[model samples]
Target: MWKEAAAGASPDLEFRAPVDAAALAEAERRLGRSLPGQLTALLKETNGVADGYGTDIVWSLDRVVEHNLQFWSPDTFPGLYMPFDPLLFFGDNGGGDQFAFVLTPERPDIFVWDHENDSRLWAARELKDYLHRSLLGEGDWYR
Candidate 1:
């Protein structure tokens, strides 16, 4: 399931997950944001991001990266931007009204829309750093 979702199909570049109403509500309350209708629908159908290698399965608020080496180049493989775990961001922000989650087969991170700069890449290192920052509330550290 993870592999299929990660490297599967779709022009929209989105992963679906079953909607957990309670979880969604709780996340919204925590993050203080409202989710968009389209995103809500997507979540109702899909569960979470597909974990590459078919081992790590990120749930509602978690995130996973799928790296495609075929098209990856030094310039493209290790993207500069980093993607966030929707579960973490949305859960923290309550729930965003806009659709923010995105996955790329060419990059080693997830791409998300930056309200300030439009969109940016969230590398795996950044993801780890963000996770650690959120957990420790200290400096940055990539896993």
Candidate 2:
């Protein structure tokens, strides 16, 4: 899905190497939570879409860990106000809005965390659907 939206003649859309299982496992270990299978699988295909790809930007594995920890860790001051179990941001709108998945109960449902309004809206229920919409540029969630 993202492989196309993220693909382009431009250099910014270049695909990164797939994340190694050991690294993904280590991330999970550090996070103490199992990553969504679909999300992990997608990342395993390509770490993430490159920069300047709008809301479709899929952060790299290192960025994933960095982002999550920056927002989820108490040691990081001014961290995200909420807890990590419920929200794990993976993409950005190139603005401030964030796209994330809820993990407390372990569902694949995706949500948009609006930066302006501090609202969480359900975007898609499955990773495939979300990726399709993203590739097609069909949703308002990105902006």
Candidate 3:
């Protein structure tokens, strides 16, 4: 059902194999936060989403770790990402901006951290809605 929902929205719709507990655990450790239930379930189903039709990718576990460790640090590279923000980046908009879960909430909410404007704003109420909208390119997010 989840795969169908995601694939139905994506243009390329490439899916990956399920990942193991250790991989998931490592991802959490790398991100330093527990993923939301829905996101955890989704990761177990497909470690990531690769849209073959030229779009953003819902990062794989390794990619997640790599991207986080790369960006979520102090002045290591050129970007707006900061170490203090309690966000676990899960996807990229293929334009340097990212999507992540805001960890402050009891149930993590989705937010778009704009790389260009250096602003963080609410994007989706939950992971599912975020994925669906992202895959379908809804909401005119560039505004």
TM-score: the better of candidates 1 and 2: 2
RMSD of 3: 2.6
Pairs that collide in candidate 3 are: none
Ranking by lDDT: 3, 2, 1
Cα-based TM-score, every candidate: 0.33, 0.78, 0.82
Question: By TM-score, how accurate is candidate 3?
Answer: 0.82
Query: Can you write out model 3's per-residue Cα lDDT over 1-143, one digit (the tens) per residue?
Result: 55776877764778889888998898888778777777788888987886765554578878777876766676665444455357777887887778887666555678888877678888887877877778767445635
lDDT of candidate 1 over 34-53, digit per residue (tens): 44443354455565433222
| Alpha-carbon local distance difference test for all models | 0.36, 0.71, 0.74
What is the TM-score ranking, best to worst?
Answer: 3, 2, 1
Clashes of 3: 0
Taking every candidate in turn, the Cα RMSD to the unseen true structure, in Å, is 15.6, 3.7, 2.6
TM-score (C-alpha, index-matched) for candidate 1: 0.33
Supply the global lDDT for candidate 3.
0.74
Output the better candidate (1/3) by TM-score: 3
Tens-place lDDT digits, model 2, residues 18-64:
88899999999988787888779889889877544444456777777
Off by over 4 Å in 1: 1-17, 51-59, 62-143
